[model samples]
Target: MSSIRGARVAALSAVVVAAFALSACSGGATDDPPASAEQTLRLSAQAPPSSWAIGNAPGGDATMYLSVYDTLLRTTPDAEITEGLAEEWEYNDDLTELTLHLREGQEFTDGEPVDADAVVASLNVSREGPSTATNLTAVSDVTATDESTVVLTLSQPDAALLPNLADVAGAIGAPDVLTAESSTLEPVGSGPYILDSSSVAGSNYVLKKNPDNWDADSFPFETVQFQIIADPTAITNAMQAGQLDWIALNTPDQLAQFPEPKYTSGSNNANGLGVLWLADREGTIVPALKDVRVRQAINLAIDRESIAEKLQVGSLHPTEQVVNPNGGAWSDELNETYSYNLEEAKALMAEAGYADGFAVTMPSTFLSTPYEPTFSQQLGDIGIQVTWETVPFQDFLTKVFSQNYGMYFMFNAFRSADSVDVRGATTAIFNPFNSTSPEYEALIAEANSSESADAFAPVNEYFVKEAWFAPIFYTAGPWVASDKVTYTPAKTFYPSLKPWAPAN
Candidate 1:
């Protein structure tokens, strides 16, 4: 969404796939070092971190970025705001301004002081970055008030700012490293670990403890290695072979094999559950989709429960909304809002004057195909035929935003009301046509106006009733770890290097 026309979208390729679905670095204090600091926290990554640019370490590079850079704030497993690099923080009475006091004696790996000026520089680059720009949408200015003090002026009270800081949007890169010629592939950060020379760019990454880390004792691993394994079978084999402490399990069979007491499982309702996004709400590319009845008809055609039972292996729950059931913005009333009814869908299609059906072109990728068959076939039966133009995984994001397709599939993390708005709002990248009605915009405004999660309840209901997203189900992301590696799954969708402690 940040300057797609600027072609900065090319910078976003590494962060998609498994990386986008993972969220949160839940804030915690390890008062005591792990039982064994000499242990290595070996984990399987679905994708690899390919960039070291500021605010560029989202998606697969999230943990890698977290390892190399320290965010100003940290989020706990509860999704509560806490401290990371900054020891203290405060907001003005109106909540438009925020001040951060960094921890003393901290410096970047390149020997530059981790001061307010460095933070301001990093924030400046991030304000226009592909991912961070959207996160800092409310910030009007960032200033270095003092050596350890940084202040932010906001255009409005952004409820998502604090949590965003805990995520990739908060990563503070060393100014010198950021400007270096090779920094794109090489990083210079002040986090708990540093990238080892033996590390390969895409295959494997080996990180060693930062000799000068301010909170050296806080992290449990002395060394960490992330293996890029794409196949679920390979990840499962790696875990069984003791090559991995945990795995980003993919298939239901993989999840089932890693049974209870021996292996601990953690899951959160991720946004990747085959959400069928109707991008051409204005009917720029597909005229029939412009009609509200046509859109509602599509929602009725999806057999969400079947997708959950047959494809998802009953490990996940089916639904019609994108909100995480555990989050405050979730509403039980909206979950089963659309029941599978082909006849009803046909009637709506006929009422919209498309009784004979219309053909549409759609973008698909390696990641989206598994969920395609049912969605495409169900629509076909109702006279709405889909023509998929499969693109490489790397080209998928750019193709969708190019406005070349009327519909596509997307996977993202559902953290708050802001998360939903970025995709549904008129300005969101997902809404290529920027289509919206006064009533829909009004609900969005009301939701953003209030910090209370309750306000978003209406917005969630509105999208479901309007059939903005034919979300097949409320999907869950499950991780399998050895019993010896116990962990607390934060409200965040992904686990970074911080949570893995050496089991007693």
Candidate 2:
């Protein structure tokens, strides 16, 4: 795995709450004997998969299913795009239509032929299903023009379609299973492995290699097993005692226990720490937030470096803009746009007529509580008070888009500039009240249409200048593996079977 890259033109395997590793640390066992009997790759899942059905799959964390489903397209170990069930695929000049040429003689566990009709049926079922439907909204129709060809007619152009095909959205299921209500309990995919029935629902899940797999080498292990463990300390202890092969180093600051000789580590380019103020740019809920001066002042009040140190996950450098440094829209100069200046912050607040300070309601979940103290103490000094509303961890996302909050903080997923500029800024799930303006919409269109990723420069600058959101840092998540396990990150993806290998 030279690099994690297959860029719809990118890929999330999710991390732990209040954690994901910060840096990469390489290790070796040159002087020790290599373990040869452990061929079955063993690891832990952040949580168990709720359903085996691709359409009704889990959101963000698909660590257990990546090995069970072979999508229409394949993403190589290096994250490069390649052919899968559909041997060849092409898009029309305007990019409104896509054609997929299916491979002959492929079959699912249920003996269903992997043909054009099957692909169309599978995709159509996923289009209407939950969890996967959002990515396929632009697809107007799916039709098998012939026995070997499937065409997708879209109402509008989508730039993320390519790499997205390698994800759950591109997963092709047997037509019978797709139509069956029991599909969620029983998976009938043609990937490297099939879910073993011996497994329990939430405790442990196992996968046995698919005898008729098309790409067996991508997943070298004959047996892949996952244990649902939420505590990082427990995971480290398991790996230390040789009970596990791999786990997420969610608590990067506590890596002293996973010392070398037995363990090695790596990370993925994944996310950014930030607070989405939600819609209400006009300050309908919190009038002080409507003023540009107050928003900018809030940006200045943040001490990114301190937050990075306290969080102890991801990079040490605090981020300065919405777009990641790797994305085309990123500008190095923007990092300097909002440096810590409490005096200047006070001045801006005073200018906005908030010299006496202001209070606003904010939501707090287990996933976001780690940073609450920093915001409370830092912002309090600048005259802004925060009142927290406690919400259950499972209900946080539902509360975010539905309720009006002055701000909510979390590590935002950053696969590419397209995902942030398009999905985060324009979609109803993330932007319900249409927080963006016509001017920002034009910039988004430009960035999406441009041949180069750099077309996002204007958009990145605008995000920082407008101070609609406060970005603290960018991160490449951490993973610690046993000496016998070789790890390769799947670029935008979370840890999965494709990136873990038996060192032998």
Best by lDDT: 1
Each prediction's whole-model lDDT (CA): 0.68, 0.65
TM-score of each: 0.89, 0.86
Worst 10 residues of 2 by lDDT: 1-10
Q: Find the candidate with the highest TM-score and give its number.
A: 1
Q: Candidate 1 has what TM-score?
A: 0.89
Model 2: residues with Cα > 4 Å off, grouped in runs: 1-38, 76-79, 251-253, 267-277, 282-284, 313-316, 420-429
Per-residue lDDT of 1-504 in model 1, one digit per residue for the tens? 100000111111213543343222221234465567787777756566646788665452366677888888876655567788889999888778999999989989889898899889888888888766777888999999889999999987766778777767788888976656677778888888998899988888899999687877778788888777755567668787778776544334656777777787665334233467887988898888788899999999988778777765634467677666666766777776678999999999999999999998877776567777877899998988888887876777577668888877665444533443333233445676777889876776666557685666776787888887777654444566777665544443333455567777
- For model 2, what is the alpha-carbon lDDT of residue 449? 60
User: RMSD of model 2, in Å?
Assistant: 5.2
Error of 1 at 28 (Å): 9.1
lDDT of 2 by residue, 1-504 (tens): 001111000111233221211111111112122334238877765556667786776644454565677788755534356788889999888778999998888888888788888888888887886756777877999999998899999877765666567667788888887868788878888877899988887777788978687766455677877776655557568778898887655445545777887788655454433544545676766788778888899889999888877676443357776555555667787898889999999999999899989987788865557778888988898998888889876666577567467566654444423443345444534444557778787876665566565766877777788886777766544566788777765444332466666777
